[model samples]
Target chain A: MTVSLRVLDDGAWVSVNDAREVSVSELWRLDDPSFCGCDLPDFVVENVLSVGVDGRTVTANVYGQCIGCGETGVPGWVPVGRLSDGKFVDIDRENTVLPVYDGDDR
Target chain B: MPTDVERWKSEVYGTEIREHLFRFAEEGWDAIPEDERDAWFERFKWWGLYHQRNGQESYFMLRIGTPNGRLEPGQLRVVGEVAKEYATGPGTNPIFGDAYADFTTRQSIQLHWIKLEDVPAIFEKLEAHGLSAQQACGDSWRNIVGNPMAGDDATEVIDAWPVIQELNETFKGNDDHSNLPRKWKVSVTGTPDGSGQGDINDLALEPAYKEIDGEEQVGFNVRVGGGLARNEPRLARDIDVWVAPEDAAAVAGGLSALFRDHGDRENRYNARIKFLVDEWGTEKLRETLQEDYVDFELETAGDDLRDQYTYNAGGEGRNDLLGVHEQKDGSNFVGLNVLVGRMGADDVIQLADLAEQYGSGAARLTQRQNVIVPDIPDGELDDFLAEDLLEHYSPEPSPFMRGSVACTGTEFCSLSIVETKNRQVRFARWLKENVDLPEGVEEFHIHLSGCTASCAQPQIADVSLRGMKTRKDGEPVEALDIGLGGGLGEEPQFARWVTQRVPVDEVPGAIENLLANFDDQRDGTETFREFVLRHDDDELADLVEPEETSYEDPMMHNTKRTWYPYAEDDELDASPAPSLADGTPITSDD
Candidate 1:
């Protein structure tokens, strides 16, 4: 119920809240770490698509609309890597595992 | 982030109501458990914030209220930072979509695609910088707007900004107003030439004076109960009271308090301040306001203060914020147009930089979403025009782009009945691509708003579109309710709603037909506004009315002002009282 996921930006760990499904290549391009530091070892990346709010659990739908889109339907999430021109690049990924935490876990 | 959303365009835009949220609210949003409520709030906030920043969605935009439309350099910088940090990523539509720092017609700054989560922080930062976004949303007293070039304009009868600021402070966070039956709008103008929409506010302070014991007192000619929205878009009726500048804020407070105590709350449809005014009449409301004045511990204006401040429209002269103008101090000022008042943060920072670099650190905002950076040297004119920003913001904007206005409709405002932003963009694009408009049409106003609340002031546009919902093929569909022949400034006329509902898909075609009709019947460069006025509804009904007419004739609603033809020198055209010159420093008068 509680999974600690490392933040891609500065490698800081936070609790995952929820996880939703999203594009895989987009997730990789967004700079998702190859190995997420979680409580369990050998946590498969194929099933660990995204980390949700508290960064606790990994679920199939982690990186889907919630984290990326925020709901205004305008994408607020930024990709991990910077573009050649130093501008922010949108991550193009699908079916990626991520860790998520919910308020109940907290 | 792209979805195979071609079939669900409305869903992509989030224009359709969120049934889940509606159901949740109805079942009782307040009844949800605390932790569960937090989950929903965070989720929704995150969703709105994400899409708002992503720039893919419509309607969930953010507006930073610039009261009296003034922005310090630091505050503007934060706005720029927000835009760059959130809305725009590379290769996407710029944060502004097109323009930058849209100087709104009401002297406010509206930025689109703002996330809800970021809003609290930005608001906090703004407050730290002596700025705030209170009353910027919900049905409350919005940013107290006056002329954009308030103190700078030479023709003003009094320095309206000080009085405007006074009223703003009194009501900005007043909880009594925060939960009113409906939103209340107030406008104050010292100029007598009717430069401000005083007649269309819950309370408007126009220029007027009274005689008491042989002494002239400059003060306000009060009007109350005016409002715009769907079924009730009428101008305020006069209350015949004189309020001094010092007492103006308290008067507004008293009036709002009165409305809060007496306004109906059971039925939302009839819950506006105007309805209360309708129920109580001006005389009775004034009496109530006076009684509340004592309870609120407010002061009244003296006789001499009244004589110096009241507006007299017949006193002479008017300025419509047009091209190439001279300042009273032998300098020059030029009005630029910012179409629809949508601007990017980067562009805004650049404009702010330009204002600082090329001229004085002073810029004048206009009621038209444009700005005039004043005190520019004659030598720098060419260099200023050479900049790429000019191409976008239009230092010398055309009539249509210059005067066009569209409020945040279903996109951001929950009260909207249709999508206004996309429609405005679509309509403007269509006109630019297809029409060959004539010249010297310096000032033609086009306003689009969702529903009638008059957020974009459709009642005053040369051509206005108020949102509507109608059944199409037995299904409820979004549409526009078009009005024509409205004009503001000097001589104001409330536009008459001509068509009840025209389907959204058919709006462009309808506009094309209307424009073509205007061109065919033109009498030499007679601005689109004049042309529309010249043609009666009977004439236009031939062009726009559908063949199978599903509803009653809209012309039946056009009965109020049939015989009131245009009059140039009517008694109502008096000039405002003497105002402080533009850009003048604050006085102890308050």
Candidate 2:
């Protein structure tokens, strides 16, 4: 199955075409040094990487700015949501409520 | 300095970090081992480089040291050119737009979105203009702060620019004093109003006069230990020792050396010079300085001109250096507000050009995040006022707009929980549109810090807001706790927390109610800060509290008592009784 992904909300949100077959995890990968410090990196989301899918689980490496010391781009693989029969199941941090896809709330 | 921080400092000083930097530049960021990257980043701070946009590995923020916050027009032009070329902004980014540059509170210029690779070239450009980022950050002495209007102020006790420049020259890149327990902040101000914020610095030199050989000589009265942070917020205390103009640098160097050797290194939080001063007391610290480092015999403080603990001579409000004020030479200096100290590169260049065109080839940055264009001739006043740049960087701003000071919030600071720059600007605009203060109240400082680090110095503002997070309807939202009645100068006081958990959306309305209440209830002579101070916490809370609105509950629909009931007697009997089994009524019987 073909999977489509798009970045939204100024790099704050990500949407996937198939929530069931493709899981979403926040990822951080090494960006090109040339693209480094280019204001905004040339990627779907800078510091986030979508690794290959294993069966139904799509792994991603997440790097986020730390709220404690203002350190950013530190890596940690966070399982944002898993796809189960086309339904998105979010497992991210508490209080991080993901938006429901159109016609999927039911 | 905690163990980790101390280790990092030693590694920074011991290791050939410059060599490693060269290697990283040659091999690229990816080539650096993951374990060493953090250390490299820490070392980079010594060179005035920080990962901007909050630790984004790709981009960096460079801070250039400006001794006394003075910059030549040519130097500023070079900075502007650098911003235009390397810096991003003046575009879609909400925080820092295309070619944006910020005038930091330390009297230095900060440019964001700088690439690691472009930094070498930027440094070269800065050096060519006689500017350097050396020792801008790290544990070493940061920017040596001086009164922005030092030489020009008619009320100035002495010109501190020469002393400030000398100290900067002596300390910048000096390895002997490079590493310390923590960052050391120094301020020197000759203005009687204490515009340089001498009391809030780790080491401050305020103007004083003494009779030496029957001649009244101007000198500096030393102050130590003032700092603002979460747990420790103490005002700097007088050390009772006075240094002549020539010995100011020596005294400063002595104090720095004392702190360097004796300051606490076990805990980073307790490592500031303030902590050492607090521990040993100013008398002991002064004795140590006089005995070991200072070669000359220091005189006791005599006839201090500084307005310590008070805002003005009248002791009413804080000194606001905004608007056009006449210099001692009859020329005028115009202080322009740069909203939260953020300025576009083009605007900076324009300011530099205007300074050269209408006045001396100099622009001064104030601690209040404002800039002053000084030395404008009387004949050039009209031309200066008519300049297009003044429209954006207003000399005369509204109370809310003028007093807004925000730290580099979550937008680029990793330690921040909420975005501060845009939020502060929006909030200021909202207050301007909504709240109307009584006449003669044009300056009220409102500081917002994203976290407890207090980089924005919220503790000293007329009204301070520290960032917080609160849940509203089970959804997390940005909020700020309210602090009121805090100020600097003669009567310096840390702000007291009046209320907490004010949601970002409700801040404007809350402030509107508070100010409206103040306008109505305050005595004709009382300032808003005084009004806040005069009232109890409960009273202050009442002023900012949201208006209570009554709404009919659906659960109480059947239980409602009406003069005329549509229900029949049998239907009325089916309604649940208002009284509990113990005869305690749930609703009022009236």
Candidate 3:
């Protein structure tokens, strides 16, 4: 099945299967060089996703090289949408938000 | 009296620690009592485990100590396999997946997303490879650092590898030093090239020679109390004592013991060895060490062979050992920049294979978050260069990328506000593409700290950026404050903050403008730090400030009248009055 992908909010959010599936603030490992080593992977979200729907869950077939490794045409997939409590919920990226700084300012 | 941390340790020693670990592994995080969690976390640090992602304490970060930054290919393969097996890829849960590792400035490996269940297996694997996470963190002596090019460099005053190993064997898992007032850092180096940064550790033993009974003796000159923290930044002071090679480890252990017993335990901030040294003075500390700790009489060193800051075309001052260099043994040691010290498991394994095949069977890590593969024969240097791993960890990197150092940013560190590793990488790439320097300017040391802790050593860079949050047009945004002219060596000075809060988006433009202006107006001999020091603070600030656009007055019909809203009357009078480039002045309507 073919699925549509849209980049929202300046590469912050990724809309997959007509739902905002990932937020840069939530999922991307911004501090880890592997994910955020270069400029935002604009190409990753900008490309279309050929997704497959299985019951209440949807899996998107994503193809792109990691911006960090710069390896292109690598096939990868991510969970785009899932059903929880009888409602479809977009799968948000995890561990992207940092702790608010409350330490000594030097 | 023991400090709170020390007291906690005394109560929770031996079987208690094992019990805590067993409980953590069997029951998982949710089963642990809320009030007892913080203490357990602190206890875990003694085993070289820390909560991953500063504030979010779900998974763990395990630090593996590499003595003097030396690792055999076999040991590295184990670390690589660990990263591939347990750390990398998707996690069991959202909070604990995609394991990766980073090389710390102290020359240790930090692995993230470590679950308690896997800790035992990881520990067994590490021990099998003669590696341990023990004492990687905590109040005990951390990793014993030495010159990464210790035996390889011909200019080295003395080989520090043996001494580093001696100290490591003496201290690792030793309960005598398992608890201290705070974390203790140590470095032992004899590189005459000044690549060894011994002046910034709690105890630094540098190469020194002295005349005794008319015969010159080679040994170490002790420097004590050097540390860098938020409120304290003190270069180590010379203790005026020369130690023989055999007695070096004893001197280090004695000093650590002294600090452990005498260091202030009430105020955590005032508990470093630096504070105690300041309170007792170097003279008293030396006297005590000689009188109380050692069996042999310590003599004062007359000659110092420590490295001094000198000009190097390929090196960043005397402390940097980046790029290719000839060894004393007629071999070549290639220092490759790891770009903020992040390397994948596959890359690590590949590097190990390369090191074993073409060069030595060992690799060394530098405090700069870079690595060195030494003992490459003169004939094999080309083949070593041709290795695919060099493409990612390049020996020949741009000056900015070569000198860029970053702390673990908000990604895994809790104390940081902005993400630093990727941001720093992007900034270096941007600088390389946008800015060009004048002749004689090759290296620009830019250090980025995720927060004020200065783990990246930002205070010692030519250009330092500290992360912070600032308001931009009434909305809060990530930002960094700029510091200039900071450096280390003979005349080390902490950088002065030039701009308080430049928006993260504008930092590149600001740095580019400043560098461009400097390139246009600098003397051929002046280094970037020297050029910055020559300028007035206000002038430097103006050089780096973002560009401002001006609008022409519609009524006057003259487009050349430059506005000086913030310029002082004296300043305007000192220079030519606000006028066009052609000296045309439009009359003010008022």
Candidate 4:
């Protein structure tokens, strides 16, 4: 099941997978480089029902219980990141010496 | 029989009425006839208003907004009349500002046990006397709080009343501002001694030095993204925008519009403008805001407004709502202590009378729950001292009153988890009587909030208390969650929750423990905030409770524990815990 990521200032990750598994730990090996987080399991992917982005920063959604937990930490978004998915991304804050941004900088 | 409005008003009953009506099969106002509608409505409204959480409900509270804690003579008299009418009973004489009114930290009047229906008439009457309750509550700007002693205090660099009035007019009920994606807050300061806590608002304007046209001029150093509620307690982050006074309102309006247009409405939790600012970096926000303001045709202040409004970086160039100080007018300044910002009618009248007797009937409310009576002549200082009100509420106050504040907790707020006013007063009085704080330790704040809503802003207090409930003998009882090391202004930081679930009864003792540590550890001229931050969680926790260092039982079990994502400790084996997710264990407080 797919899950959304909630990133902290220090690079830690928390994801509530579709199978209702709420995992918060250091990043494991990811298939893609840009994502910078761990890979979730297959059964956890089965439970993913829906997802949404929170103001372009964090991703959130509703999902069924994780195969791991007996209905614990199921309904909330655990923070994680997305890889390139065959696309390019830019780091906006790092662009200018002190970036003066305008609308749609996102 | 005709139907009565009381019979139709299902929302009138408190939680207690549900059980009583069910058990006795008793008829409520619902059974009253239509012809007796007005009489029934009056009786029912009175009964509802009279009903306090304790059931005696004898004291009905009416809160009057003193914009940034300012009040005129007539306003004071209005409050006095309300107190005289409500707080007094058959045998009980109202205690002036005690059972009467206690001037609040926020500069508002709150009278207790006022019948609900009479509230409309009371508001109308106050309006007749040149006051309105429109900015009091609900999806509105609320009161615009400025430095209480705006113009009179000699220490200030510039008077903030004009700017405060400007913003209040520009944004208060402006249709452009009425529709917000979430609630927004704004505060302005004329000097660096920030009586206005800068980090707890959506936008904060502070006095800072800047270069314009090759000369140093006073410009507002703007900060954004400060807020407190639930698990999201954060100080305002700095936005690289130094605005002149003339441009302050436009910036305010621009930010308001930005929040209205772009802030999150889908999830109420992520609704505040702070969340949006944090999510979109402050630099990006500033850029967008510039465009927004440009589109709105906001006039950027020319040098004329800049040089005219030079902010005075006065004595010590820091906050001072406590202690006797020299004002710009060359008169003595007296700081009146109002514990927890709960001002009543008699208290308002007394303060107004004192102000008139001593100065020009002008008083300023401090961010701390107290009032500053400035510009008193040397001769009148003696007369000011003779007033009997000074004993209970002193001008020569202690650190507790100078630093202590409590939000309207379970007493009135439907969102509150515990009672705040009585608890804060009890604790403040107890500490003053018992604890002998370090001499010259003029300010030390202790804020008690009813819940995580943080209306009292517990995060900035030297020793902060957030309300919680712990099960004692299988019943939930009120308690406090202790926080340490919050600072405001130039070096701003959010206080960390140090101790969890301290029973309300033990709050005084817990404070005693913390103060005892401060006495031993503090260097010369160190604030309580400095002392707490100097020590880690273990060290701070040890100071609060030396003998037993156990914090586990209270940490996980209590609702007051504000949870956040934590990185797992590598030392713990990655054994999959069954109930929770596989992977490492992480917690909010690292």
Q: After superposition, how far is residue B92 of candidate 3 from its true place, in Å?
A: 13
Taking the candidates in order, what DockQ does each have?
A: 0.01, 0.02, 0.02, 0.02
Q: What is the TM-score of each candidate against the true structure?
A: 0.63, 0.78, 0.76, 0.66
- Looking at model 2, residue A74 earns an lDDT score of 29
Q: Residue B442 CA error for candidate 2 (Å)?
A: 1.9
Worst 10 residues of 1 chain B by lDDT: B557-566
Off by over 4 Å in 2: A1-106, B14-16, B53-55, B89-91, B308-318, B546-590
lDDT tens digits by residue: candidate 4, B1-590: 21122233333322233233232113422233433333322233222221222211122344456666776545666666766665432112122233465454445555554543344456557778766544443233546665676666675666666777888777654666754544566777664467656567777776666677788776577778878875588777777777777777878778778877787765545677778877899878878888765454422322212222211111133344655666777788787777777665566678778888887776666666677677788878888877898876686667677567888665444344566776677777778787777756656778898766787878777778986654445444566778887756546677888777666777777778777778887887676666766789988887885222222122222221112101132111221211111112223231
* B347-399 per-residue lDDT for model 1 (tens digits): 77787688777766556655656676666667776787677888876756654
As for lDDT, the candidate ahead, 1 or 4, is 4
Give each candidate's interface RMSD in Å: 20.2, 16.3, 18.6, 20.3
Task: For model 1, report DockQ.
Answer: 0.01
Put down candidate 2 lDDT per residue, A1-106, tens digits, no spaces: 5544422111223334511111111111222222234332211112233333334544444334322222345232333456677444545333242221111211
Model 2: per-residue lDDT, tens digit, B1-590? 24545776775652255566666656655565644555566677778887543113356678998888888767778888998888862113444457778887778888876666666678788988889888787778989887777777876879987888888888877777888877889999887777777777999998889898899999888899888864368889999988898998888999899899998887655688887877888788878988998888888987886545344212353466678888999999888989998988888888889999998878888887888888999999998999989988899888788888888765555445455777788778777776787767767778898766687888888778877654445444566778888877666778887777666777767777777788899898787677877888888888886431221111111111111122233142333222232223234333
Docking class of 4: incorrect
Deviation in angstroms for B353 in model 1? Answer: 0.6
Pitting candidate 1 against candidate 4, the one with the higher TM-score is 4
